[model samples]
Target: MPRYDYRCRACGDTFEVSRPMSEASESASCPKGHADTVKLLSTVAVTSRGGAVPPSPAGGGGGCCGGGCGC
Candidate 1:
């Protein structure tokens, strides 16, 4: 199950619900029992154990992959 954020227009209330991806577009009833609600776009933050990603080489690189063409 995935959590979704919803905002009620009738009562101006916000709530969260967990449901299947297939039901992601389904309208959810607010806690106040308002059916006129809309799902909100959410943001996700990603982190890696390897730390930040390294910057790519300037002006691109060799025609080969990974700039390791021995140019």
Candidate 2:
């Protein structure tokens, strides 16, 4: 299941839902009785190996250290 962010166009309320991807389009509504809610594109945080990997520097090679350091 993936968490999705939504915004209520009728009530200006924002909320999150955790469900299967197939349910996203059908489960869009505001808890405040607003039916004009829409899904909002949002960013999600991801961690691997119990650590967060930082983004690579711009204009650098495809390596983690930005270049070959032989570390």
Candidate 3:
């Protein structure tokens, strides 16, 4: 199941709901029983289970294609 955040336009209430991916697009009701709600554009941050995130290849100190280009 995936969790979704929704905000009610009528009551200005915010809530979260968990449902199957297939029903993710379905309308969510607010705590005040308002069906006129909209899904919020939320951000999800994923971190590696192995602690620190791996550095980007482009961020490598100073080697261009393994020093072949000698840049």
Candidate 4:
């Protein structure tokens, strides 16, 4: 299940709800029972379990752009 953030205009309260992706657009009520609510745009950060490392150049440091160009 994915979590969605919603804000209630009636009470000006924010709450989180967990539901399936199919119901992501469904309306969510506030904890205070306010129906005038709107879904908030949120950001999700996904990380790898193994901490994978990206491949670098043969020289490992020198590239077109200063110090951190993996190309």
Candidate 5:
């Protein structure tokens, strides 16, 4: 499930809803029962599951100067 943010123009409040991605485009009612709401643009942050990424290899990583072509 994914969460989406929405702003209620009539009540001047913001709320969140959790639903399937297929229904993400559907309108959401505010918590105050206001039907006049607009979906808000949200940002997503991605991270590695291990909490850290592997370091890059030496020799500048593979183009022509990775010590294979002697550059």
Candidate 6:
């Protein structure tokens, strides 16, 4: 099974569903009873080990250090 994000055209609500690949593309309606819905092309974040790592700031700070954070 694969997870897919769907947006309801009638209600403008976004939700996620986990289903089979074949049904994923066909089923785009919201489970809350919205029929005029479409599947949205959502992105998933993934990280690689030691892949063009960015440099960090010299000083240690709280929260984000502003070191080329992708998030």
TM-score of each: 0.74, 0.57, 0.67, 0.66, 0.65, 0.59
Candidate numbers sorted by TM-score from highest down: 1, 3, 4, 5, 6, 2
Q: After superposition, how far is residue 64 of candidate 4 from its true place, in Å?
A: 9.0
**Candidate 2, 7-68: lDDT as tens digits:** 99877889988989778677676888778877888887766886776766664675656666
The C-alpha lDDT values of all candidates are: 0.89, 0.78, 0.86, 0.86, 0.89, 0.77
**How do the residues 1-71 of candidate 6 rate in per-residue lDDT, one tens digit apiece?**
68988889888899988888878668666778989888888887999988987765654343554434433
Give the distance in Å from residue 31's predicted Cα in candidate 5 to where it truly belongs.
0.9
The candidate, 1 or 4, that scores higher on lDDT is 1
Q: Is candidate 3 or candidate 5 better by lDDT?
A: 5
Summarize candidate 1's per-residue lDDT along 1-71 as a digit string, tens digits.
89999999999999999999998988899998889999999998888999888888854655776566755
TM-score of 2: 0.57
Alpha-carbon deviation at 26 in model 1, angstroms: 0.5
- lDDT agreement of model 2 with the native: 0.78
Tell me the deviation in Å of residue 46 in model 6. 2.7
Which residues of candidate 4, in runs, are more than 4 Å off? 49-55, 58-71
- Which runs in model 5 stand beyond 4 Å of their true positions? 49-71
Error of 5 at 64 (Å): 15
Q: Please write out the lDDT profile of model 4 over residues 7-70, one tens digit for every residue.
A: 9999898899999999999998888888999999999889888788776656556656635665
TM-score winner, 1 or 3: 1
Report the lDDT of model 2 for residue 25: 74
- Candidate 3 clash figure, as a count: 0
Task: Decide which is better by lDDT, 2 or 5.
Answer: 5
